[model samples]
Target: MDRTELAQVLTRARTALTPQDVGLPAGSRRRVAGLRREEVAQLAGVSVDYVVRLEQGRGPHPSAQVLSALARALRMDDDARAELFHLAGSAPPMPGTVDEHVRPSVQRLLDRLDDLPTMVLSARGDILAWNSLASALLGDWSLIPRRERNIIWQRFLGTPDPRRSTVAMDDDERRATDAQAVATLRATTARYPRDPAVQELVSELRRRSERFDELWRAGGSSTSWPFDRKAIDHPSLGRITLDCDSLHVPSSDQTVIVYSAEPGTPDSDALALLRVLGTQSMTTAG
Candidate 1:
């Protein structure tokens, strides 16, 4: 991640919002597209030097309240707000988790979603278990080595085969995804702070990816409700953006992510093609 560029973007985003846009009066003789640093500082309840420090990427990390104020002052959306946290380098405080021994119940819920593209995920975005449809959608999940089963690991390490078309996610998308991965892991770390798997994953990511190292210090956090979308490519499906939903299984630390396409869209056709290929594979195996 380009810290300097990110800082500039924050400043630019703040400047892009009109005073009237943020419910401030538009005074005479303003010569910029958005709010001034002093205005943002006043609105966010921080000092001009702090805002300047933030824009220069040299400030103390802002508290959540200050961050929220800035986000509002800059008219940031949810995604933008999350990205700001990433830029400022502060993670959210952890929420409590249920005990770890409840995996069986979670697995049972996974079984119930047999036809959906669903899987049980650990706090680190690790694929603890998946339904048959998820395995099918992912195209040969078991073929993945254990160490690469985590979503973040897969994205960073999985190179597309020559015959497979590349799915290029911009740096922002990759960073956002990685931030979620880290925050998910952070939440898990809070509950099972001693798990060797979690420790190993964190250490490996930190050592390999400078971006991960930068975001790791920020303590980004997320929950398992609502959904996010990603345009994914499969050798057979070509390219499809799946609408993915994440939910927490009651009394467990695991999350379930299910993917689907909009009804009657071309993406839906791609999902059908995937199902056909999956059926053929099953028949051949049988």
Candidate 2:
């Protein structure tokens, strides 16, 4: 690794970004012109110490995921993102295919939302990483095989069950969700035309589900993924409705999904209860 050069690049990038650019608040009593190492850490989902090490050129080489997150946090363009990856001793990701790499910064962001249901999805709809509460609320995804970790695959190929969602969806709602899933998959296929696994998935779906095949013929795009509203039905907690929000790290082609209920509402309390249940399950497992 070119430690000196990497450090210089990181320092220069960090110094150039403003809080406004990254959607951070501009607090008072600021000393530096740009964001602090800690602020950058928060934005990038890394530790301040790691940020310091990187800026000082003393840290170990970063992963592609970390470099990509830093690229987004620093608002680097495509050229700069490629440079970041190259300096970190990796090739740039192929165009059209989304990066499936989940950064530590993203995990840190998930860790902070213990009371909410949060999960990460790769460009191909694979469930990458999810917190305990996400498992508790969304059903235990970890129990499923890795090959079956894809959202589109499970929705269409699995047993006909709309209850895969925590809430009861009317026929129209279920149809819409199904259509969206197929459309998203179609768009992904268009983007990663050469990905063997994705191609295999398309073949499998076409062979198995007539609905998926029909939708495949129709088509869909990532740009049209609707705003999500999710509801989970817990035998113990009843139902909790959450407004689902997504943050995409375009460079990595990974998205973090957070499900939150309005504060001061019963739905919020239900989510808190689920957190407790998740904690209990962990303790028991340990």
Candidate 3:
């Protein structure tokens, strides 16, 4: 990579963006045009030091995810995004690959949904981000290693809450869930044959789980993911059942899982309690 050119390009890009462009408050105490380093860092989900290093031609190459985030933060169009990747000495992510780039708009949505148990999952089932309530409802996914942070992997190979999830599944429901998961994985493999991470996941699942392989061979697929209810048997909160709905993001092909209960219900009360517990744990850990 031409560090000088890369730095110049990065600085130019950063200087070309404005607060209004990336969903930030327009401020009056501005000494310069475009976004500040801290603003860029916040929008890109990175640190200010990292942005400074990138602009100064001293940092290591940013990963694809970082590049994508920066491109989005700068409000670059598709062509500009491609040029940014080229200048950074990395090829732009091609179509058909699983997009790991969760847009800032999507991330903002997650951050704003503090009361709900929400999580973002990549097309291949990788857990990208989760809210505090999601951590309380499901396991704290962030603490898990990257390799084990996948829903399909967790279901098939990893030790996941041996004492059945509060999202109660009868035998038939279990079978359906397994089939759906396998189908999703199989579809991902078909979509991104060249993605090594995705390929490894599929290979590992097929080798490690007989049921996964059987379902894969049987070709489980549907038009879309189904809306379902989850019952989580919280060790403290007892059983809390909530409606589980998924929203598809066209830009990234990611799914956002939202957990909610009808207002004023007992389940809603339980979720509120879980939120309290989640907040307390975060505070204690901090």
**Top model number, TM-score:** 3
True-structure RMSD for candidate 2: 9.8
Indicate the TM-score of model 1.
Answer: 0.55
CA deviation > 4 Å runs, candidate 3: 1-88, 161-166, 279-286
Each prediction's whole-model lDDT (CA): 0.63, 0.72, 0.75
Off by over 4 Å in 1: 1-105, 161-168, 223-227, 279-286
Ten contiguous residues with the weakest lDDT in model 3? 277-286
List the candidate numbers ranked by TM-score, top first: 3, 2, 1
Q: What lDDT score goes with residue 217 in model 1?
A: 91
Model 1 clash pairs are: 15-34, 90-218, 91-218, 91-219
**Candidate 3 per-residue lDDT over residues 1-286, each given as its tens digit:** 6778888887888788665444344557899788898877765677789999998998888988688767766766667788889988899998878876667688778768867888888888877666667867775553455567678888888875533244567899889888887777777777778887798888898899998888988985653554478877775567888899999998888999999999999999988787666523333223
Tell me how many clashing residue pairs each candidate has.
4, 1, 4
Top of the candidates by lDDT: 3
Can you write out model 1's per-residue Cα lDDT over 1-286, one digit (the tens) per residue? Answer: 3467557878889867775444344668987778888777765556789888878977675775466556644656556766777766654323342222224455556557655667666566655555556655665343454456577776555676533334447888766666776676666667667556677777888888887778889876655422488676665556788888888765555677888888799988877666545423433223
lDDT winner between 2 and 3, please give it: 3
